[model samples]
Every structure is written in structure tokens, then in C-alpha cells.
Target: MRPFLLLLSLAFSGLLAAAEVTLTNGEWPPYLGQQLPHYGVASRIVAEAFALEGVEVHWEFYPWARALQMAERGQRVGTAVWTHSPEREQRFFISEPVVESAYHFFHRKDRAFDWQRLDDLRGLRICGTLGYNYGEPFQQAERDKRLQVRRLPSDELCFRQLLAGRIDVFPMDKVVGFAMLHEHFSAADRAQLSVHPRALRSDPLHLLLSREVPGNAELMVRFNHGLAQLRDSGKVAQYLLDAQQPLSLAP
Candidate 1:
């Protein structure tokens, strides 16, 4: 009878242990957005991975900088889909890659742009998003005043300036750039934009679990296990495909 009571207690505690994790997020389309289906692919992936472990995620959306600040301050469980950085790794338990992004230069087709290195962009009018890191070399070039850059508040603005001939080139994620062009611009405008065959940078984005919050390290580990399982099941690739080509793909 005592063993049976012990089993009941354990089952009850197990049910009680089924908990929800709150995560901070921001707008990064086709990857994460408040309006997109499943809050975009990356957020969906995070939610599903946690679901596999019988955990639920409650998402909180904020400005990108504020999202990072809130998560790092342990106001939430973590932030999703951030590119790996050494400074971040020092403060958070970085999960295995949630997604990877390849950034390329977007230019008008008539402009015929090409570049082997930063020096090649010396004379062109470059546009960049404020608070974005294009990579170390690009940052160094900008810091040294070797490249002239006009900073904009968002990618849409940068692309608008590019289309208006006010900006010669903008660096953006390839999949995201194409998605934005298709969704926001006309077919005519889409024809005018071209991506450089070479990528500026390729980085894997991860879940940043705050070290300031005790037990989050274990949570990161559990999330990683579920993430690995999701990857192996081939759903991540399919989800990405759907996000990238929403028009033609049947989800």
C-alpha cells in the first residue's frame, strides 16, 4: 500500500513538474515575427522542441535590443535565434544552432556589382541597418572610415533606399532578402534586385539561456536534446523550406 501511495505521489509531482518556459523574441521575418504563422519558423522550431519534452513556451516580443537585455537580465528564460558571439557565450548557455543565415549584398541588377574584398566597395554608396554587425572585417572597415555607410532603422528602409537609387548596396540575409522582396515588393522591383553570389557571412543562430538564472544551464541541455531530435527527424529543414518558399510549398 505504501509503494502504491508512493507511485501516486510521484505521478502527481510529475504532472506538477510539467512547466512553461518564457522566452523573449523580436521581429526577424520568415525566421521570427509576431504576425507570421507559428511566429515564423525559428519560433515554431523552439516551441516544438520544447513540446517534445512536454514543456510549453510563452513568448514575449520586444524590440531586439530590449529582448536581449530582458533575457540576459534573467527576466525571461531566454531569447531565440541570435547569431553566436563570444561576448554572448560568456553570459549565456548557448544552445546548439537553431538556424543558420547566409548574408549577401543586395544591389540593383543594372549596377553590376561585384566584390572580392572590402576594398572593392570603397566608392559605392553602402547602406546598413543600425545596430547590426555585418562581420568583423566590415565593422573594422566602417570603424576605420574606409567605407561610407548610411544607417537605416530597418531592412525595409534600406531596401527602399536601394530601390530609390539613394543607396548602392545593402547587406542582408539571402533567404530573408528574397522573402522580403517577394512579400513586400512588386514583381518588377524583385526583378531589379540581385544577390551577390558570394556571401558576406554565414552564422548559426542559437537559443541564449541566461547564466544569471540558476538551473537554466540544465534547461539548455534538455532543450538541446530535443532540438537534436527535431533536427534528426528532418522537420527543421522542411520548416525552413516552407518559410523560404511559402508561395509554392504546401505545408
Candidate 2:
């Protein structure tokens, strides 16, 4: 390698490091949130992936629905950590999964509860969070009058209802649920909650770049490339571990 060639490569890397991008985000604790370390796990992954491509990420936090809308309307570049659906696929260029997560029903330990299927939830009061899809099977059951679910504004409210005996069960991402409880509840309050053993559903979350934003198609390509590198190096798993640690903080 010639000295000139090495210098050119170094110069190019510097230029890439100077590039920046902004995206919309929302609260989904221990994963994506404004308050957590590195703004939570998923946020750190998304930021690091872009940084690998020399693109800095500036996040605009909002309600989950508004985050989607701002990105869908191209008011921002895109949004992070959304599950794919046919409607979303039509409007956005989806990146490879940033993280895989599963949801489980959280209940009060005082109340005996067990379920092999959604049908088992027949007479129980189920709490649903707004702007979330519990998947088609759960939805269909709710529509058919087999499951009773009441929608709420956030996971915090759902948990509050559960403690108050206003709701029998609430489905939440396993990590997010525990993370929220750990952050906001007392030891006694935490003791009162227990997650069901069976998972409700699992989904691979993604970064969505709206078609309305020019140059985003190519940006998606660059992002996926960076994400592949991140995964291959095993930092994705390490980041998740770090994000969950008791005193996880920005390094």
C-alpha cells in the first residue's frame, strides 16, 4: 500500500465521520426511551449502526404514534424500532431487524392465572397499550368476543391498573416490563407483579426509512451494511447486556 493511498483512505473516513442524520423515536423502556442510558438498548444499536457509516443520529422523541406519523409523513428522516406490517412495508424501506423482542402477560401474583392460549383469557380483564399490535390472533380473538381487552395510554397505566385490581393482565415486552417496574415501582409493588411463563408473541423490530424522504433508499442500504457489521462483531448482544445491567451508563 502506498503512503498516498493510505492518506486518501484516512481522509475519506474523516469525511464520513462528519455526516449526520436525525430520526424520530418514542418510549419503550429498556429498549427505546428518552431517559434510559444511551436512550435505551435499541436506541444505542440504531445510533451505533449509523455511526459505523459515519452518520450521527439526532433523535426526536414523541408518543409512539406521532413518531410513526412524523417519519411516515417525512417530517423527519425515519423512525426506529418498529415491527413490520403490510401497511408499513408499503410506505417505508425496512432495515434488517435491530432487535428481537417478545411480549408476555404481566399479572398480580395474588391472582392465580395460567393460559395455554388466548382462549384461556376468556373472562379476565386484559389491558392493552395504545399504538401497539398484539398480533392478528389476539386481535381476532378480541373481535370474536373471546378475549376482553381494555386499551390504555401506556404500559405504566396498565401496570397501575393491574395493582389496583382494575385489570387482570397486561401484555408487555419482557425486558421493557421489568425495566419499567425496576425504575418506577417500589419493592413491594414489584413483588406484586409476575409475568406469565408463556410468551404472547415475538417480533423482530426494525428501522423504517420513509419513501417520502429523498436518498433514503440508499441510506437504508448503508444502514443495513453497518448493521451487518455490528451483528458480526457481536456488539449487538453485548450492547443488550450492557443496557440491562444495574448501572448501565454511556461509555
Candidate 3:
């Protein structure tokens, strides 16, 4: 009887001491969030991949900027669906890209305008979520004062602002915009919005580790191995295909 109790105590202690990965997940639908369960393909894929290596993940959801801040502050270990920009590259270690995201402009169809280049955006109000970088063109426009940009707290807010005609254009990742529009927008709202034929930029999405996280190299290595296993097993492609189904983010 005493032996049985001692063994149980040891097991519980081990459980309590397990190496846990605390992750910061934001409410980016079809990528990471509670609003759409299976839609978090990247998050779920990473979680599943890491589990194969005996690593456990615990997630806390926050606004996108806050999630990035938590990870940077070491209050959280990592973030997903992150763009690997040079500025951010210096701030964090990045995993190999898990997916690619293209940037597109969402605008009201009846109010069409020829947005040929960054210079063409002069005097237009553009909407974007805080902490998101949609490549160089828009950034350049921002620097030149050619474009008026509003930083929303989330994608849902951007959609709402766009629907209300408060902003001239909403610049978002093609996949993310599509997912959000399908998940949140009403049929009427959908009718008003359309994607620009011209792409602003296309870049790969990476899993980012905060500078404060310990064992960065080892964590990245392990994740690479796990991701390789998933790719070899045909799981990654399947996840991407599965998450392609449309959802709305209309406010």
C-alpha cells in the first residue's frame, strides 16, 4: 500500500514537471482561434507535429499585437502565422515557413479604383491590423504619406470599418481576408467587397520564437524535424487543403 502511494506521487510530480511550451495564439481565424476550431490549420498542424516529438503545447489567446508582445516579453514562448520581415527577423528567431500568404486589397466593388502601384495609393485610407506588415509597397506608401492607414485591433474590426465605408481599402493577407470575410461578413457585406486583381505582395508565413525564449536553436531544430515528419507523412498539405474552405470575419 505504501509502495503504491509512493509510485503515484512520483508520477504526479513528473507530470507537473513536464516540459511545457506556452504559446501565444491570436484570434486570426483559419489560422489560430476559438471562433473556428479546425480552421486553425497552422496552429493545429504545429501542435500535432510537436506532439509527435513528445512536446506538449499550452495556448493562450490574445489580440495579435498583444500575443506578439507576450511572446517577445517571454511571458509566452512563441507565435504562429507570423511574417518574417527583416525588422521582425532581428527581433526573433524564425522557423522555416509553414505556409505562404499573399496580400490583397479588399475594396467596395462599386467604388473601383486603379491601384497600379504604391504611388497610386496617395490620399486613400487603408486599413490594417496592428502589428501586421504586408510587405514593402504598403510600407513605402506609409513612409511617403501617400496613404492614410488605420490600425485596427483585429481583422474583424477592419471588416467592420470597411463595411461602414470608413476606410477606402483594407489590406490583408489573401487567405486571412478570405477566411475572415466568410466567417464574419453577412451576405450583403460580402456583396460589397471584392479582392483586387493585383497582388501587393506574397510571402511565406513562419513560426516565430521570441528573443527571450531559452534553447532557441534546439526548439527550432526539434520543430523542423517534426515539421519534416509531417510533410513526409502528407499531413501538411492535407491541413492546407482542409483550411481552404471559406469563412467570414464581417463585423
Candidate 4:
């Protein structure tokens, strides 16, 4: 009787655990909005999609690095808008990509930068987000003194500084650049800045779940399933299409 009772208690506990999951998010605009009513684009999408599956999500908005660490430590159940790489793949289970983005350079329209290659950025001050990864070439350039990368706390700060001539160029995802331009910059500022024709890389964005969440690997599967349904039903693409304005895709 004692063993039977213990098994019953464990079953109930597992049920309770499966019913609750907290999602952590960083301040990536249009994807995750820190100051908005709802977390933002990705958060809203994931929330509504998971609701269809009866999975409840608690959204916790935090800085990018903190959110990443929380997801890694299992304190936070999940993170959205994460790029897939070998290192990250080992640490967490990744949901199917809900969005795609291009990393590009934003320069003053009046200035002609000889940015033929990553090495061409030498001696020119380039602004970038602290936690953003711009692929191998730029990272190597930073190491070899071929680029001077200044770390800013956020995209808004980076672009504002760039406009003031405090930084020569700012690197950011083009979607983010368009959002920030509309949110923080005046019409005049928008006219002054232009995204470079060259793209650093195209990345598929995913929801990252820490290994600590109970059955997290399974949860990733569920998330991806919902994402697929949303895409098939035309919800996901419509969200992105709505956000894509004045932000043209690369030909």
C-alpha cells in the first residue's frame, strides 16, 4: 500500500509540473518587446499557438544575456528568437524557427564606406550590440584589429550614437533596424541612415529551452508542432509580413 501511494503522489506531481512553464525573453523588438503591453511579436505568436495545445506560458521579459543564462540554468523554461549553433544546440533543445533575419550594417547615407570585406572596417568605429553574434569573419576581424567594435547596451542606443557621429557604423538585424528607426528616430534621421547592400548572414530564429525543464525536449517538440500549424494556417507569415515595411528583402 505504501509503494502504491507513493507512485500516486509522484503521478500527481508530474501532472502539476507539466501544467506550468515560464518563458523568458530578451529585448529584441518585433520579436520580443520589453516595454510593450504583450511581450511582442514572438511572444504573442508563441503564446497564442501554445494556448491551442492547452500549454500555459508565463512570460518573463529580461535582458538578452540574463534571459539566455536563465534558460541555460533551467530557472527559465524557454527563450525565443535564438540563433542555432553547435554550442547552443548542446545546451538546449530548439524549437522550429518562427522567423528569419538578416544581419546588415547601417551607415550614414552621405558617407561612402569602402566596406568591401570585413577587414575594411579597420580603424573605423563600428557599433554593435553587446550580445549579438555577427558570424566568424567579423569576430575574427575584431580579434585581429581589422575592426573596432563598440558594444552598446541596445540597438536604440547604438543607432542613436551613430546618428550623433559618436560611432561610424552600426551593425544590427535589418528587421530590428527598421523597427528602431520607426520607434526612436525622427523622419529626418531615417532619411540619413541606410542599410548596407551586403548581408553578413541569414539566420533562422528559434525558441530555446533549457535542459532542466521537465521533459523539455518533449516541450520543444510540442512548440514546433504548434509553430508548424501556425505556419500552415498562414498566421506566422502574416505576422512577419505585417512587420516588413520599408524593410525590403535582399534580392
Q: Candidate 2: deviation at residue 57, Å? A: 1.2
Q: What C-alpha lDDT do the candidate models reach, one value each?
A: 0.89, 0.88, 0.79, 0.79
User: What's the CA error at residue 13 for candidate 3, in Å?
Assistant: 19
Compose the digit string of candidate 1's lDDT tens values, residues 152-235: 988999999999999899999988887777778887777777888899999999999999898888888779989999999999
Each candidate's number of clashing pairs is 0, 0, 11, 0
List the lowest-lDDT window of 10 residues for candidate 2. Answer: 242-251
TM-score of 4: 0.82
Q: Model 2, range 1-251, lDDT digits (tens) per residue?
A: 69999999999988855667789998887888898788879999999888888789999899877899999999999999898889999999999999998999999989999999877999999999876789899989987988898999888999999999999999988888888787777777888888887999999999999999998998999899899999999999999887667521111
lDDT of 3 by residue, 73-122 (tens): 87778888687778887778888878877788888877876778787887
What is the TM-score of candidate 2?
0.88
Best by TM-score: 1
Order the candidate numbers by lDDT, best to worst: 1, 2, 4, 3
Cα lDDT over the full model 1: 0.89
Off by over 4 Å in 2: 1-18, 245-251
lDDT for each residue of candidate 4 in 21-81, tens digit (9 for 90 to 100): 7888877777788785457777877886776565888888787788889989988888887
